[model samples]
Target: ESNRIESINQSIQKKQGVAGCHYFSESVISPNFNVRITLNPDRERKCSRAVLRLAQQFPGDAGAMAPFFLNYLLIAPGESFFMAANEPHAYVAGEIIECMACSDNVVRAGLTPKFKDVNNLVDMLTYSMGGPNIDGGAYSMDNADVIRYSPPCPEFEVMILTVEPGKQSTFKNPGVPVIMIILEGSGAFDGKLCRPGRSYYWPANTDDLIFTVDSSKRGALKVAMAHKNLHLDRPTAINREDFGGASSSNHLNYPTSPRLPYMGLGGGSTPVNEDRRILSVGSKDYAEQGLPSL
Candidate 1:
């Protein structure tokens, strides 16, 4: 404990300078006074005093230092990372395409002037400390024209579609709602001219959506698509006798059939061709129109 406190004090001294340390020492001397010290963001390196304070407060929580275990990820174009729920992560820099479930609940630990819910974050974390799995592998379908990123979560799956210039590709909708974003080159989506920065949300069972890259375009058409993983096949029942007994409670039961309505948007009994009055407007207008009212 003493060694750990010394190590923290040394880091604080190096980052906070003499005046900050003096202020901290004086605050420590006062029983009624709160130790409110801010480190110089420009000078501070390695650990933060705020993080040390959090660690000191919750010595039993191994997840308190989970942020420190983070490894820098240099994600190039067309690369991606999948972060599960309750996984601790922070983007130090750079911008990339991000697809995530619609949830506003955020528990920040540090690296922000906002409220730091350390206790809540520690309690919610997975507590697994290590660099992330950076393998950029995906299942390829249709002669490598389509790449699917099937994360373990049943919520969503991402698909990358590539169409060479003057060529076309057809993707059979998996009977689920989907959203597509054009990443590069120009293309026609179901006969609509779409270029980079264009996005579309298709209702469930859109069936045989086609993408044709314009021959006039110089590069291959790249698009990132996301949709619910509702069509995944699973076994109906488990033969428990092979493992132990049929009456055992540990026997697994997978879904025998596809779900009636998909889990995400447009999951109702709405017909796919019902002309849901889908609008193809600019992003600025879409934002003004709000969330589809569907």
Candidate 2:
């Protein structure tokens, strides 16, 4: 934690830690919001969306200048970055695979007809001047194919797994529950065709899984997974049988904080495709992992 973060949290520890990560699938034309954005519109606004504009579309709120101070960046396909709590950002354009904690307590800075708590928002923002680097985004784990993105909050982390066509890759379970989505290409998972936009659930401590990317796709198969932050930064392959097979009853390193609304807050310009897909896990699994029921 940096002094800046500590200072921000000190004002309100568990108040509104809203953070997330994004993996760009298409080369963004403009405004990949934060990667967060805030009050300052220091430079010329390059991108304008149907929702927000420095010219006119901005709501008459106090911070309406942005649709201005809010930061914007262009991201190439396959690049990603983390958005810490309180950082202001918006994806003004392009499609992105975002993995964020499911929280209803989002503080919209602007670009929406919804409530804009500009006063509270002003207090929480880091106001860290300058735009972020597009090149310096998510990092690779022990497996280069897996682009690892673990944000500051403990709510969740994300993984982008890519496999080339006709090439087989094996991925071992990390002894934790994970929800996956196929971003591109095609494959088979237990008789189900895993193709773009398809999702799956993998149980904890499952056996080594193998994938053979379909040759007909002519492109790499990409999958994005949202899983518990199981202290897996540089993860290595693991076999469940070798550990004697008691994969359940796992707990986190620290006492789980109250899964309240986001510590920091952000919302998209348009409300339609807000990626608010929340899948319900079984109560039995929650009990085993010390997780609360959704």
Candidate 3:
């Protein structure tokens, strides 16, 4: 016990500590509303949604932003470098469906106050180049219904979906799990309906899910999706485990923080979990190591 206390004291002894640390999937990321933004475009602006932050290991203080938010962000499909890091990011006023490595370790700099370790936050962040800059607006698809954007990250990918009234879109998860967010009009999946503000998750091991738009209006459905892809050689399960129902109708009730083993103030330091069977890739037994399948 004396040794442990000494170590803890050493860890926080300096105003600015170590030069660096890496993020692993072992961390936990609890959801917290760091800030809020409202848009009013009618008076030169309309009502826009509130911005929310997601990170791997959020130090949860004001100083954390100095290192993490110091960089800019740009997201696209197939292009997914930002998601791989443990920096705190905001989903500014737009609904996007996101699915990741089944880990939530956020190291924040300008968001919450869960763990205000400024020294680690500054050291762990990547001061290199900013985020991915692929714009789907540059490409014109003649055959594909969905416009896929490739950011640069390998752990995740995104798709911008546009469906007309009475029409539908189909995607096969293969094994990787998927998350969908409604960006425009109303739509329904399986049987549950979603509008401009709702979100849903399809378990990693699930099969292809169907999305249908309301036939009452033209272009009634627009959705953005974030999903895991097959990049690493490791095998993962494709079983569709329900995220289960919300503990409360409020989004605040869900667990947004990543789990343990990856809990810390810094970001992008955890190792990939050998037991991750949440998102299926190619093989039936796609474990990083060989663990009993979930």
Candidate 4:
């Protein structure tokens, strides 16, 4: 692996206008070698092909390249992947609906012009080898209509909810703010219209939110919801069984909680219960009102 990396670096350095030893360390090496390559379809395609060719030539050395050494996964619509922190990965193609933590502490290794924190990335990785483990980090809820993608962290949880046409689903709030996006068909969220290309945010402690797909819609109404896991006071047996047992720090034992609901396309209605208060970005006096931001 080191030999292949060294050879690739040397070749990059010898290129007339390239200034860096690494292929993706400088823009001149391939003009589109920087981080921008991840966003440009043409550049990404060329880079993927180049990486595949290199991998084929030196199969033994390909492991060291980490993420970029592998070919892209052609993820079809409705299918998705979970990427945790410190995991080396890159998105090569297609549109995706990403639901992640609010923080932006990403550590990039290559395929971008962004700062490559090589040492930090190396120190943070789990170093597990082999192809992508699709089943390693995923778990499903008892309700077949919902699937939870729980990463080994207590701060966030992602759930995919499917409401069949003419059917409905109810979610009890987990007492945390939530962000949701509609992925397929049309539905009524808490009696409000929801459709593709739209997102909604619901404040913490909102009452049970109901969702019903329009019977006229051709397929089920699919939505991706993300929120913090605030109800981890106890761990379940299933949580302990995941990832070959819970981590020493208990990061993997995220206790199941009632899923939260995010507002959809239409004006949010105030909870009829006079005691319950909901705050949103659209609140009339949001700027002047003194409410803790989620």
lDDT of 3 by residue, 1-294 (tens): 985575345334321321222221212212222332222222211111111222433443232222221222223222222233433334322223434555554544344434435455555543222222112221214325565543334565555567778878776663766667777778777777778867778787676667788688665576766665443232121111212222221111211222211111232222222212122111111111111101
lDDT tens digits, residue span 1-294, model 2 = 685575444334312321111111113312443322333232222222311342244423222233223333334455444444555555544466666667565666545667756555656555433223222134454566776555444556677778898776767787888988887788765556688877888999888667777777688888877887654453221111122211111110111122211111122342211223221111111111111100
Could you tell which candidate, 1 or 3, scores higher by lDDT? Answer: 1
Q: lDDT of candidate 3? A: 0.38
TM-score per prediction, in order, is 0.55, 0.58, 0.43, 0.53
Per-candidate clash tally? 0, 22, 60, 4
The 0-to-1 C-alpha lDDT of every candidate, in the order given, reads 0.44, 0.44, 0.38, 0.43
Better of 3 and 4 by lDDT: 4
Error of 3 at 90 (Å): 5.6
Badly placed stretches (over 4 Å) of model 2 are 1-54, 59-64, 130-144, 230-294
Per the 3 Å backbone cut-off, how many clashing residue pairs does candidate 2 have? 22
Candidates 2 and 3 compared: the better one by lDDT is 2
Candidate 3's TM-score: 0.43
